[model samples]
Target: MPIYTVNDQSIHVWEEGASDKQVALLIHGWSSSWFAMSPLFPILSRYRCLAVDLPGYGQSPKGDDPVSIVAYTDLLADLLRQVTDQPAVLIGHSMGGMISLTMSLRHPELIERMVLICPTISGRLSMFINMFLGPLVVLERVPFADRVTSLIETRIWRITDRVMKPASYAERSAISSEAHERIKADVRRPGQGQIRAECYRAMRENDLRGQLQKISHPSLYLWGMEDNTVPLRDASSVVAELPDADLRIIPNAGHWPHFEALVTTQRYVRAFLSTPIKLLKAQF
Candidate 1:
């Protein structure tokens, strides 16, 4: 376990695999912890993996400030510097994908490669959501906001466990009941509603579309073809913007391909990492 302070909060890190190989930073999506990325660690043991709790999740402490996507990216950049001198490969899911994209745009030199799983680049959220909830972003400064958010999150967790998560796995039958149970457990971390809500509030707060051309690192866009949660169409457009990128749609996977189609996703991940940077090209 490694702990680092950013914005007055402690971020906990979990390390796995051999340190001799290149570094791979594993970032979990919203309402998750370093443990959420555990499914990929054993398969991708070729590279040293650094997984983070991202404040308010796992054992990490929530800072006095509300969490935003930009804040996450900035903190990650500093954490990257403190962890290793070598450029690292970024592997992010959902909101983690947003942070990784921002990191690549703001600190390109620090990235060697990237793998995004159902990242929300654009066209995911509707204007109605932003219009209704955007003002709540400023309310993060209010002490009572966290209390209200936690109450709302309780209802969300109930619905998510009984409905959302089961629907996320396209090949639900392919995975064990235990796996789905683990996912349900992962999303219900304590006192994390404010971090979760603020992250959603932070989406589209930054414009990263046009700047995708600036990312020269070999990138992989591994998305679920049936991902209704983030939509494959939006991800495809983002992939088109990348200078050197590949897109692989898992036919039988939905939002959480890493868990639903572990073997197939693992194969794609290993093959992508094995390829030389210069030979990296777009593929479906």
Candidate 2:
């Protein structure tokens, strides 16, 4: 783990692979840290893989910065400008995917391509989460809410983790126990109540469906067939909006397809990255 100073904030990054190879910046979703993306490291070893623990999560302190897609995109743009001269590949999941899409639209010169996994493209999420979990986030505005939220947040996430896993035991076993623990650890981190509430609110309020068509970068979109967090129909709608993008829904996989179907996910990523950008664009 290496900590880099970006916009005067200490951003923790998990760097892997050879420096001489092409750069691949991996961004994890809400409530997750760089460790959540560890499963894809082996497949992306051909590139200089850099996974970031965004400001609010993991080792990075949220501080006073407002957590929004634009704020995150600015932080990453500045970080990349300081670190790499050439454009890098963006691999983003969920909220991170929205950030990547925004980056491509805002700073197209800094991005070569993108890989979005089960991205949240609209304000609409699963009815269950929106109905149940969304209210808890709103309670953060009330007195002593942080204290109250801290106690139940862990329980809620643990149940969510189990529910998000694949149905089959073999598919569930594909994701290491340690990986699941890592995600839980992020929830247990101090001051996460405010961050979680803010992030959830931000994600729910932000919608990028109309803006995605402006993104010209050749992109790959992966969705879990059984995803309940972001609907499969929404995923298809998002892919259809993009100018140069393709969608692959992994069967028997849920929201975390990269972990549940590692081999299949890797194969798709490898093939996508190996193809010429021109060829990919021509397909659309």
lDDT by residue for model 1 (12-127), tens: 88987666777899998766778667888876777788898886777887767656777888888888887678899999987788789889888887898899888878624434
Give the C-alpha lDDT of model 2.
0.79
Candidate 1 residue pairs in backbone clash: none
lDDT of candidate 1?
Answer: 0.73
Every model's Cα RMSD, please? 3.7, 2.7
Q: What TM-score quantifies how close candidate 2 is to the native fold?
A: 0.90
Which regions of candidate 2 are displaced past 4 Å? 141-143, 151-174
lDDT values of the candidates?
0.73, 0.79
What is the Cα root-mean-square deviation between model 2 and the actual structure?
2.7
lDDT of 2 by residue, 1-284 (tens): 78999878989999998777778899988778997788888778678888999987988988586677778888898988877888999999878888898898889999999999888888567775677666866776454988776678667666656644432123434566776666667656766767877778777677887777787888889988877777776786775776346889888677788887889999999999989888877875
